[model samples]
Target: MAKMTHMKKQENQKSHFNHISHKEALVLTKIQQIKHQKSMDYWKQLVIAQQQSGFSVTEYCRQQDIKYNAFYYWLRKIREEALESLPQLPEKSTTNPQVAVLSATTVTAAVQTQSSSLKLFCGPVSLEVNEQTSNEMLMQTLRCIKEVFGIC
Candidate 1:
């Protein structure tokens, strides 16, 4: 019983969160936001710079003295975050103005026309596109796959 009590006390102590004044908390939150924005801005600039330099990711990272994995990690994280902000389709409906249900026939048509370098594959579902594919088509295609196949 004594050992159990000691263990419980230790658990409670470890579970405790910092108690701070409301104003202090607000200040800390703002500071964190500023830091995050700063990092995002820096990375965003780097992304644009890489594109403008006409260098492959590996080459750009080498030229900029950035870790290749870190560059790719941040790039994917930033893209996922951006995609998250886009309006999502209803779970049970494809009637959303932004999302369209794609039949297997439609997918076949798309695949036939796709000879582009940009290809996205999720499980057995795949989408291929290039500069010509409108944002709406890409959004609808992705959402359709996500809704039907539980993928994104």
Candidate 2:
């Protein structure tokens, strides 16, 4: 009788596994697709908000209570999609684009005429550097800026 009861339990389990109808399976698939679309929309909104906020990614993510790694992952995915959508440049162009060439003397004259201060802009962040800034310090500062804004 114990053996017969065990066989009955196995049969019951098998029946439970096979209980879903084809229509029910289709409904489950639709539900999953909707959930996936909602997640994608959420990420897209986050990317847009970050861009418009004018703050660095780290700061923006922090203000929004988002994970830095997850924010970066979504940002990278969005940028990849944007890059893929852009028109491709021809491998061999019929006409070459005009290139501007500046001589050393021209550059020197321009630099001499301008103030000793240098200002660099990256999106919303602006960095001002003077001749007194050390090379190592400038390099380190630029690295930090790049990390925060993903650009210099």
Candidate 3:
């Protein structure tokens, strides 16, 4: 009697697996794809918010009750997707551009004119630093600036 019951259960399981029609299977696949896309979008937004919060990844993950590994995995996956979606740039020519050299006097004059503040240019971003800024604070500020702008 137990063997017969086991056989019946196996048959029921087989029938359940075979119950879905082709259209139903396709609908199920589409639903799964939508769910996966939503999950990816959620994680991508979380990563962006964490980056803008000015907290380290470890600290952010800890505060958010997220696993560090999962956060990093999503971050890497988002970056990879972005990189893959970018259009490839054309190759540069072999010709080198002329280099302009500034004289010491010119550099000195420029420095003298900006004696009260130091200007740092990174790509299109510019930062003005007061003369009283400490070395450690300056380094930290530069790091924060790079993080904000994603500069190399």
Name the regions of candidate 2 deviating beyond 4 angstroms: 1-18, 76-152
- In Å, residue 67's CA in model 1 sits off its true spot by 1.2
Better of 1 and 3 by lDDT: 3
Tens-place lDDT per residue, model 1, 1-152, is 24568888787766653556688779989999999767766776687678668899999999889999988877776666566655665577556557689999999978766654498877655777787777986886686455333457
> lDDT of each prediction vs. the true structure?
0.72, 0.73, 0.73
lDDT of 3 at 3: 57
TM-score of each: 0.49, 0.40, 0.47
RMSD of every candidate to native, in Å, equals 12.1, 13.4, 11.4
Ranking by TM-score: 1, 3, 2
TM-score of 2: 0.40
Best by TM-score: 1
Q: For candidate 3, write residues 13-100 as lDDT tens digits.
A: 8898699899988998999989866776788668767867889999999999999999888777766665554445578777986677
